[model samples]
Target: METYDALLASITPGSGETRTIFDPATGGVVGEAPVHTVADLETAVTAAVAAQPAWAALGHDARSAALFKAADAVERSAEELAQLLSREQGKPLNGPNARFEVGACAAWLRAAAGTPLDPEVIVDDGETYAELHYRPIGVVGAIGPWNWPMMITIWQIAPALWMGNAAVVKPSEYTPLGVLALVKVINEELPEGLLSVVSGGREVGARLAEHPAVGKLMFTGSTTTGKAIIRSSADTVKRLTLELGGNDAGIVLPDADPKTIAEGLFWGAFINTGQTCAALKRLYVHDDIYDAVCEELTTVANNMPMGNGLDENNVLGPLQNKAQYDIVANLVDAAKASGARVLLGGNPDPGQPGYFYPTTLIADIDNNNPLVAEEQFGPALPIIRYSTIDQAIEYANALDVGLGASVWSPNLTAAREVAARIEAGTVWINKHGAVDPRVPFGGAKQSGYGLEFGVEGLKHLGVPQVING
Candidate 1:
């Protein structure tokens, strides 16, 4: 393995003012990140705005070629990137964690490169010729989340750069290293400041949202922060793509097989320790198979081991920060106090060094409980029973936040029928939060406006310029 000091390159050695990052797995000091000032963010945004014209003027083919090379660069350094992600992000190195996230960087980069979104020749056959062109928006400010730090940052910046705009990133303070490293890898092949990183907390993010030079804002975080971003952008009325919080629901049909669905159910809720904006938080299962589903889900939860992310055998890891750890622990404790059945792994061992919460399953919980009503962005799943499909649908659609939802049933038609009724941006028939780079994802209700991924994602990143003659 490369020395730990090598990952430090991601953070440029700034002045005396620096922030120490802690390793989520061991709670040890990992490295220092520059406590970026508003001046630093302003500098980055100004540089991006200045750098954008040349990048956009390079034309699609040339820009794509450069991004393709960046993708190659990411693939070449996948190991180092994965290691850095595991150290700071507190996700397992293997499985759908750090390595998987690094691999996805390459995939998303390539997909962005290969996207064929040429100018559309609208009304070409008529007397007047008109063409609609997706033109580059100036500087795009990307404020990313911590859960899937590297991947989420890529999801914003890659498409923004590929669409012929310059991108400035401000990753979550908790998991900044991986994204910084990823950006460093890509910036090697690109023009200076076309892609930039400014590391700080909310103040930095708010500055980006309010920056006049930043024509677009693409953010992924909580719904509360998303509203703030919207408010901050009101000054500039900047275009935005916000993928906010999700209290996603999953409804299992009566005929579904518990054994067959258990693994998916486990991952749907537990992946990234349920920190995902789209991870299924509450499950509404038909009364006929509710007990069986609970049993199988409990078995899945028990079988999986949680530990340091660096361990290859472990699939689950610690909560990336203390605040989130407390949220999970307190919610689980409250659920236990409320007389809900703790099916598996509720008691957290505080004696342990890291912020480790067990894979908890709370059964027979009321819908109004915090674990059910709120977005429990941690490794806890609450299973609720409903007597009919109508009741399940009611429970699923009741929440104000709807980023994603799922319907599990053997009958594809029935699953699709129910999925249509759920008010979410992305509804999966048999899976929850199964995102593809080619499929668009957003939110409904208060989950936030705009979408990410696919052709629509690229189109929205830029302003539509029409030539009428």
Candidate 2:
């Protein structure tokens, strides 16, 4: 196992213009991320274009073997990567945060490697035969978000590589070092230039999206940025898979036991300090159990330790960047101003050095309250009360962005019925934001197009071609 410093050193540029990465937990220096430019992006793209053909020629079995090795490589440096991720991304090492994200990287890589995608026989008659096959789209450009940076980057690149395409990653500016380190570890088992990270700014990302050589672009970030990427990739007509913003909702059915479901609801909303796109943000509790659910949720939230990611006991950490922190603070403040009851943690210490917004749970907030209406994307959740299931579903689906949602109820039958009506990619019964590598996940109605994960996700990474006779 490598030390954290060793892992950080591996990705650090020996000589170049660099950006100082600060630890969000302590405002301390994490490491220097190389400020790569558009020129660097062009060079990386050229290298990927040159490398893709031989990679494709290696065939699926060979590529899968390489990915499996890459997964092993990621495991070898897992501790180092986790520690570095904790420092750079401000996610706790112990929880489903830093270490979990690193583990997810390996899991996703292995899943992409092992998932079978044999050519499908569409039709076969005596007079005619037809089969459907997926071909590599050459070089794929991946632009990842700060939240779950390393894992989501793997989500984009793993399938691309599994399908015999090279990848060029552009990590979010807020958390580049973690991605750089992750890509470095994975590259150890793969051929040179097969996968690379361009730690650059918006300009480099813009170039990557628009570059003619990039046949596909996978982006996981804000809807605004997703749209910009769409426009940029339009001229090149690049195949794209975009997982954008999500203000995911969770409905607590009247039948749900508030005491029993409290922990699940807390973690679903507060995981990674609520930075996840699919993490439950707006929660609608049946009026019959509104007060009970709020009390239970607050009790659960109050117990979870929040502080520096390096601390073993602290499962919650600071926001990855100040901008996100401000967004959360402002939205919560706006909600408070709207006369919403602050069940717990509406106030944060002004003297706190880090962007440590306390785990906030706002109750009696209107569905239209800014905190409920907007994607706060932090350690805050708005609990809204609904008198009817129809009202809850209406509130949940009011927003155009629907990535994931959940209905908490013991009645799986009723839960499934509610799940179908909720406009989102995936809905969990009695849980929320529980993503599986084998299950397909994507957004609906402007939450961004294209599917990810499972065989469908693998298909997204390739271009389908039908052989007809």
Candidate 3:
């Protein structure tokens, strides 16, 4: 296993044009990432196209074995990866943050290797027989987001590679070093030219989306960028899987014990310091227990330490970048101006050097307030009060983006009933954003389409074919 410094040295560009990455928590120089251009993207695509057939010809068993080996590679370098991710992405090393994200990469790679996907016999009558099979899509282009860069890159590429497609990845400009290091580790067990990372700018990403050689595009980022990819891929008609922006809602039913569910609610909304795409952003608490719920959540939020990610005691860290920090700050300011009550922290220390926003909990906010309505992707949550279940459901479904949601209640049947009424890709009972690799997850409405994880995720990376005899 490579040490953290060695791993960083491996991905850091020695000479060419590069961008210096800084730690979001301390503003210290992390490393320099190569600034690949459109020409670099083309070269990567060409290499991927040339290498795909041999990879596809390896058959499922051989490919799965390679993926298993790659998973092992990830495990070997897990600590180094976690440290780098913690520094670059500003998620803590402990808790469900950097280390957890690194572990998830290994788990997902193993899941892609182990999940069975055999051809199915559709019909076997005496007169005729038919079979359905999935074929590789040649080359896949993966565009990952900064929030969970290492894990989400694994999410996009693992299944794609397992299904016999070579991939070219474009890491988010904000967090390129982590993704580059991750790909470097995985490539240790992979065939040369089969998978590559081109850490480039907008032009490279745009080129990858429109490249005729790329048969499919898997993207996880903002809704606006997803739409742009859709437009760019129109000419090539590439199969696209997009997991976009989400302002997920969590409803705390009147029957729920505020104290029992408070910790769950805190992590649901504040995991990865609330930078998750599916983290609960807006919460609706039944009026009967609204104040109690708010009090409990604030208590839970107050105890969690927030500081530099490298500190083991600090489970939460600064926002990953200045732009995201501004967005969260502005939304919270707007909420305060609209007469929203700050239950915990609403004031940030201007003297702080890094992009650290306080763990803020806003109560007594209108359902349609900008902080509640918009996607404040930070450690701030707006808790809205509702008197009726029907009203809570209405507020949750009012948003166009429906990536994920949660229904918290002591009564299982009631929670399931409420979960059924919500329009989202996945709804947890009494929990939020707890994604498992065995389950299929995607988004509803504008949150973007195409499933990732499990057997369903493998099928998305392939083309269906039917044979009749």
Candidate 4:
């Protein structure tokens, strides 16, 4: 039970830059975190590169076993981990919270055990044969975001190691402690640099991405940052998997029930205080049920309790950090100035410390509004009524982002048809953001490049080597 202050004493990185971790609930300083230096990043990369070959040589079974052991370690530390995750990340305890994260981490390890890699075969007459096999791409750099920091970090590390590559993770500056804590528990089961956690801000992350020894980079964050990583990674021609920002649209067709639609709308938009990248930022409802749907959704959203994550009855928690709080606040203000009608909560409570903006719902907005087109990345969702299904699809597809979209219609036939039409990497029919480990998760267009969390994910960590024999 070492405090963050005690832990900071041993760790080096952000040497000169004195930063403090906050208890978001109380607006209290939780502990000090070093803003890592560029040289520290180089040391981490060098360790990962030097340690990776031996780890890769341990072969698949050993690697998979180690991952499972790490998963078990995570499970054993569930209570402590969940509390720490809540204290650091501000996610409510009611939702799957840290328990869900640990389960997913373990499930990923199990799924990776079953995922098989293959060597591509070429036609051979008699003596000559040719095949292409998968080989570890050396060291990988994983950059994780503040929202779901531990879960996404596990997502990045699990598949890379399963494919025989070592990973060096840079957790977001806002929620670095969760990853560091999780890593401390699991690192024993892994080889020295098979998995490592480094803390800091942009400088540390940039160094990791551009490092010559790092063979690939996997990132989950804003589209703006992803673009920078894409440019920086080009120097080494490293393999990249980016799960970037999403201004996802949830389409509520006329065929959908107002009551059911209200439920989906609530979870899709307000889950994680609407901090999820794929959370519904814009809602395109058929004009027929627009009024009724909006009313019901407003009722559901406004009634939910918001407070500290440790409060058992609280349904929502503060935004993870101040910058995100400002982003949510500014978006609400802009939508209002642009004449978008605020149908529900749109303001942060003055008394609330941390980033606690209300579960806001805006109406009478078209794609022209920033809330409709831009990634709000918070608890505010704007509803745009559409006269026709085509109009809804058109608006949903209009954005440069294509991360996730959901079609809410009870009719399977129509929902499937509409889901196919939406230009997003993931389309949930009658559900939103219900992710599974077996599925490939990523995005299309500016949302991001490459995939993670499934069979396809493991392939991304390795390079295809073709040999003729």
Model with the higher lDDT, candidate 2 or 4: 2
Candidates sorted on lDDT, descending = 3, 2, 1, 4
Weakest ten-residue segment in model 2 by summed lDDT: 1-10
**Residues 46-101 of candidate 4: C-alpha lDDT, one tens digit per residue:** 88888888988998888888888888877776666777777778887777565566
Cα lDDT computed for each candidate against the true fold = 0.89, 0.93, 0.95, 0.83
Clashes of 2: 0
Q: Residue 105 lDDT in model 4?
A: 66
Question: Which residues of candidate 3, in runs, are more than 4 Å off?
Answer: none
Comparing 1 and 4 by lDDT, which wins?
A: 1
Off by over 4 Å in 2: none
Clashes of each: 0, 0, 0, 4
Local error of candidate 3 at residue 467 (angstroms): 0.7
C-alpha lDDT of residue 271 in model 2? 95
lDDT per residue, candidate 1, 80-162, as tens digits? 88888888888998778889999999899988888889888888767889999998998999999999999999899888998
Candidate 4's displacement at residue 29, Å, is: 2.0
Maximum-lDDT candidate: 3
TM for every model, in the order presented, reads: 0.98, 0.99, 0.99, 0.93
Candidate 2 per-residue C-alpha lDDT over 268-352 given as tens digits, one digit per residue, 9 for 90 to 100: 9999999999999999999999999999999999999999999999999998888888899999999989999999997999999
